[model samples]
Target: MPDAIDVSATPSDLTLVQDEQQRTKSRELSRAPFEAPPAIPGYDLLHRLGEGSFGAVWLAREKRTGKQVAIKFYTRGQGVDWSLLSREVEKLAVLYTSRNIVGLLDVGWDHEPPYFVMEYLENGSLASRLKEGPLSASHAVRITRSVAEALVHAHGAGILHCDLKPANVLIDGNMDARLGDFGQSRLVTEMSPALGTLYFMAPEQARLDGIPDARWDVYALGALLFHMLTGAPPFRTPEAEAKLAQARTIEERLVVYQQVLEASPAPTAHRTQSGVDWRLADIVDRCLERDPQKRVANAQIVLDMLEARDNARAKRPLMVVGALGPVLFLVALYWIASTVGPRIVRTAEHELLQQALAGDAVSARILASSIETEVRIRQDELVDTADWTYVRQMIRDSHQRTKDELSQLNKGNFPDAELQLAFDKVTNHIKVLEQRLAQADRTLDESWFICDAQGRQIYRFPDAGKSLSESFHWRDYFHGRGEELDESVPHDKVSPRTKTGVSLAYLSTSSSKYKVSFATPVWDEDQKTVLGVMARGVHITDLLDQWEPQIGKEGRPDDRFLSLLETRGNRPHLLDHLRIEEALKRVGTQERGEVILRVSPAVEKALETTDRLEDYRDPIAQLDPKFDGPWLAAFYPVGNTGWTAVVQERRNLTLEPLGQMQGVLTRGALSAFLVFSVLLGVLWYFLHRASL
Candidate 1:
């Protein structure tokens, strides 16, 4: 046990005790007065200052020192336990050494239960001052800083003033602050049923099985600051039930704070009663962050911010003089450009024109068509991988079925059965295959499309084809040689094959893999002269589905896994995973399997690279190395038409280890708390003169 110091400032007096008894008797006539004489102590009873749910505090003058002090007496039936009293005494003893903290003078049994003596304060608590109005921002900050400094010391000693509030802080004659009420304080690691006053209680402290931490004090400090600035705590209400409900969740309290901040008139616009700075209001807001993690970690940070704000204000004049001076000195430079710079430009242009000449039309047209094709291919490839795969598979299945039926007819195997039966079977199979083909065609027709060099449609997904140009002329194929034509190929007047139904076209001569007819120039074989333009298209949807099996196999439980390919541009095409998987199964049995095509960011980048267009860039690529878990993704490119794949997984399954680590940390914290409690008890006994 810790030692106790007997610093009772009030002198022994019987008159004060009788006066208190009379007041108590007047308040409650039914209650009996003490029949036994108040004895067994060397202290005197004094006039009662206030009574609360816990106990009453009295102002008394110690007989030995003749110093005025406040003595708090706990009643036997006041719902306080001996163990709780002992813990409170322990905390007060440790905190007494700090000047800003209310010092515990002595603990003695003057009546049925023990009472503790503390240094008396002349000025009332901050709560009493707030009864008039909210404090000016600077005044509140100054008071808060003093209390915070005391907390910094207490926390350093592993003690938390769990019940911190305006009422618990005393103002001296000098207006300096002294933090009081260690009756509910505890070591940082200790978890006690007695937490804090309802309004000041942290959400975690309200939990039945919550593990106490330093954050509890942090929250109370914020609440105190809020009260100082706003004239009330964030959740103060006339009804006790309402206050309790608000204390249940930190988020609800934060919402209230945000509403108050947003709705309340700006403090800067209002004049302060005390000549205090308004900037302190911002600091209070910061301290009241909804997330504990985002709050100021300690008192030091608050002090640092205050100091920095002061320093910046002090340096403002210097900044204006040194930096602003140069800008003002250079005001003449702007007018010089408008008045004298154009004549020199005309002279230079005239000299350069003599050296320049126009290039040949044939070579220029070919170059322009090649560049246009490349740009179109790149843009088409920017479709999402999942969408691309679905569209590709649909096209591939349609083509395969068509080819298979043609082969069957060529093989002459349909005449084996009776004439009626054989005809019916062939008709039924053809109808079913035709339906499949029609569905595939519908899907591919809706996919997006872009033509390559020689007027070939290198990327013709259904969505792309809907708006593609039908016909292409020689002039349309080779227009913009000097400038880059990286824009999307729009469906306008170009002629398309109605049977094949291509909606849009572009030319790409940059890569061999996707070179299309749009890139090829028309030639007359007999006359050996350039003729016109030819168009070609690649079924983009068919190519996308080709990669579905690989993605599905990589993520087992194909049904559970969903893949998507999105185009890397505005109004991108979508290829759903389920659609592609169905297409792959229809392709028949192959070991490596049919390639399911899907548009993805990777495909978009590959297309762009092949199209002689700038490569697609991803911002999240920087964060990928850190995120190692699986997720359902819905990613898209930041600027370019590039696809982003968003994958989502079960939260519990993904963060299992993190949960286990938290459990370990929780247990360790609890164990550390218990050990600290025992040490606290020992320290308290030695300091309070209760040592064994």
Candidate 2:
């Protein structure tokens, strides 16, 4: 081992060759309280400032420089190991020139009270500041970084601040940390064990025979930082203290301390504290590792990591700006392209709409004419049935007989044979009318019937024997008007609202299909007075079949289709394509009967304006509950009837070229974006490699 002697000082005064027991006894004897500050030559002691186990520190002034300094005096008594004082002074002298270390002014070994002077710091120590409470993260980190720098200097000088803690760190006038009080400092080659504060010492260093290592200071630095952040040391919980109190000897207590740190979970309160980021927490955790080898190698590496953290923080704002600039530019370009593309699409859409409307108008007119022709043929046939002499005679005879039978029925008398003969005659007459109606070229009539002038059915072909209620007076066929009466009118007051009529379409409960009746009044021999009425009934689905094929099929909104509208009343009503298809399926089959058509606001608005609509939009396509999209629509009147034919073609299908253009533009933009992304990625990869 190298001799513990400094050549600059006297050999007897500077040499420290004492053993461990003698040094312990010297520290005990040096703690003797002094009654007054001891005077030292070349330095005037002002007053006693603080005291430690080995010495008392006093405020003093240099006579030559008039500079205030702190002097630490070791109490001289019998059996004192003067080597203890020499060893501390030797370590301090080696680090005196460092900015992070306290400067040693002079040493007075032969004085009555052996003393050494150091530069006086007005700001005191970190332990005094810690009494107020935990510091802010920024303040704590700054202090910690300064202390770490001081450790870097001390470690480089082969001296370990084994007792490093807040009390050992003095703050200068500038508020920077200067590590002081190296009384327990050990050189790298020293084999003697040194003890440090309990909670701040590493587990491996918490032993009586522990040798001084750089890791011990590393652990103490972490504990110091932990104290500054949380206002308390790590693993200083009540349970740990309870176990520590049970140990009787220093060796046992040290063993308990090691076991407590090893058994307890790592400290995390620092991590959860406000402003304590993961990077700082990680540094503390690595330094406080239970395994000495796992701890940070030295304080210099901790200083470097803190610098790296600062560098990362400094680049954060620039990184955000670099990323946002390109993203915003691409967004602006995309917005401009979208605006221009839609305008071009709308321009082509307007021209296509005009052509589609013109074509639909022609189709509507043709379909209306065809429906009118078919309806007129059926109406003529109905008029011919009413013109038959026997038809008129039979209706008058049957109405008279029904009135007489009803009179008898009121009196509780059974209908007579004469009433039975009258019904048979009307039945034969209806059968002949049915044959006549069947002979028509486009015979779509479902049934034929005769009614009394009072609107009571006398007979009906196909279901002549079915007994119906006396509720026929309110039927549209009997009154020659599309609307029904709330109550029946008297036989004497019964009159036709129209001479010949095509009644509004109605849901037939038995068939589940809509039916419309064409009726003509049967007159007396003079052809001036009405006797009764003759009518033919036809399902609405049959008429739809005639015009539906002339338009397109019922599929998507874009498919063309024909809608027959009744625009005579408070609102127009049209048969839904889906409903019409359902009715067509039951034409010759049995199914649940339909009750009524629910009025749709879209259908009403579309057909309400006029019997002849030109260049109109299909409101049902645009505003219906499903929002099917716009269509080019045209309406044409079916003869003099209140019915109108609406023909429509989807506008999107008509302007298909616009969709193709948009698709091409979309593909081009996506391809460009992909290429730009690939190029940017390649550039970034090259730049990253070059930087490495």
Task: Give each model's clash number.
Answer: 122, 0
Best candidate, TM-score: 2
Question: Which consecutive 10 residues in model 2 have the weakest lDDT in total?
Answer: 1-10
Query: If scored against the real structure, what TM-score would every candidate get?
Result: 0.40, 0.44
Give candidate 2's error at residue 580 in angstroms.
99
Model 1 error, position 415 (Å)? 82
Candidate models: Cα lDDT each: 0.45, 0.68
Total backbone clashes of candidate 2, pairs 3 or more residues apart or in separate chains: 0
lDDT of 2 at 534: 78
lDDT of 2 by residue, 641-672 (tens): 78877786656666676788779878988886
CA error at residue 430 for candidate 2, angstroms? 99
- Which candidate ranks first by lDDT, i.e. highest? 2
Error of 2 at 108 (Å): 1.0
TM-score of 1: 0.40
